[model samples]
Target: MAINRLLVLFLLIINCNLYFSQEVVIKDDKVLLDGKQILKAEKISLAQYSFFSVKDDEEVLLYKYMDNETPSYVNDDFFILNFLTEKIKVESTDLGKVSNFMNSKKAMEKIIKWLLKERVINRNGELNPDRIVIFKEKYDENITARTLR
Candidate 1:
């Protein structure tokens, strides 16, 4: 009876760990967000409208579509750099153009510079890298918040 009870206990612990683990896996070139294999890009694009965990995923899209002010949290290091949202803007551009903009190093630098100039991100001249949760729509006012911790 004692041995049987110990085995049951061990199994229970293992099951609990598996239940709460947040590892996303990718197989066959498909990305699995929290064990749900994303078979199509449409699903991913739709899912981008909602706030989701940023673990094991290489890229994320944030959608902001409301006009109410919301709270957000940023890493202290990033906060000091002032990389928070004061305003957001979206443009009527194609996905290809948007993708190119995001991938362009020069564009990214310009964005960072603009953010620093506007006091939206760190301007202390020290790079305090932290994950930033950003809303996709511009001037929508609704802010979705997330934390790396």
Candidate 2:
């Protein structure tokens, strides 16, 4: 009986971790990595993505990725945008044809704008103050504002 109880507890822990490990998507504005919204500005800034625990008074560099060339095929659509600590990488099933789309500035801008808008990255470059509260509701205390700070 004790062994069975231990196994059940272990399973519960694993399930809980898996449930909370996935990215938390914001309902209204949608652009969130983990639980914070991405920042949209003329120049992409890393500070906006950094956790609040980071020292704001410290100087940091932000890097932006721009498509320098056009994609080669119409089917080359980006399907996922993943963010790391300091960099964001976009992935597409038709990666070989991505260059074709990248070549058309208008096409590239449209795609980028859609991603920004969908992800809730304010084009005007402001952080959504309610993000933490909203995230907590969806995730049920899995993440907290104090924890972020």
Candidate 3:
């Protein structure tokens, strides 16, 4: 009877862990922010983002988003970075905060172009670091008060 109870408890733990899983993907060159792709940098150097863990002291990376932020913990994709290293490393610390600002649909449509400095595209899109300032200015122009914690 005790062994049966232990098995059930173990299964419950596995289910809970699966429930809170999350991910950050890096594809092509652009970081896929939210369901849509955003933020085109000249070349991503240190492409990494840090978030808080559900467990205390023990840092949970790779598969943890945050409290009340996982609209689809198991299947939602957001926030992409750039890098290709087989080794996986996780660390615990007060990384910082991730916030999303509301914007108009029109602004959203031109986001990629604005991020790429409104440059003419040919075979592949080019990035201009100088235009990033303009992008920030434009982004701040259409920000809303609402933000996720």
Best by TM-score: 3
Greater-TM-score candidate between 1 and 3 = 3
Q: After superposition, how far is residue 92 of candidate 1 from its true place, in Å?
A: 43
Winner on lDDT between 1 and 3 is 1
Candidate 2 residue lDDT tens string, 31-147: 344555433222223212221112232212121222223345534223323333323333434333223343333332333344343432344323333442342233232212223
Cα lDDT tens digits for candidate 3, 67-90: 234554523323321111212322
TM-score of 3: 0.25
Q: Which ten residues in a row have the lowest lDDT in candidate 3?
A: 81-90
- Preferred candidate (TM-score higher): 2 or 3: 3
lDDT of 1 by residue, 1-149 (tens): 99999999999999998886444333443434455543211122311222122333322223322212233421221111122232233322222222223333322233334333333333222222332323233222222243322
Under the 3 Å rule for N, CA and C atoms, how many clashes does model 3 have?
Answer: 0
What is the Cα-based TM-score of model 1? Answer: 0.23
CA shift of 23, model 1, Å: 4.7
Candidate 1 segments exceeding 4 Å error: 27-30, 35-149
What overall lDDT, based on C-alpha atoms, would model 2 receive against the true structure? 0.35
Give candidate 2's TM-score. Answer: 0.25
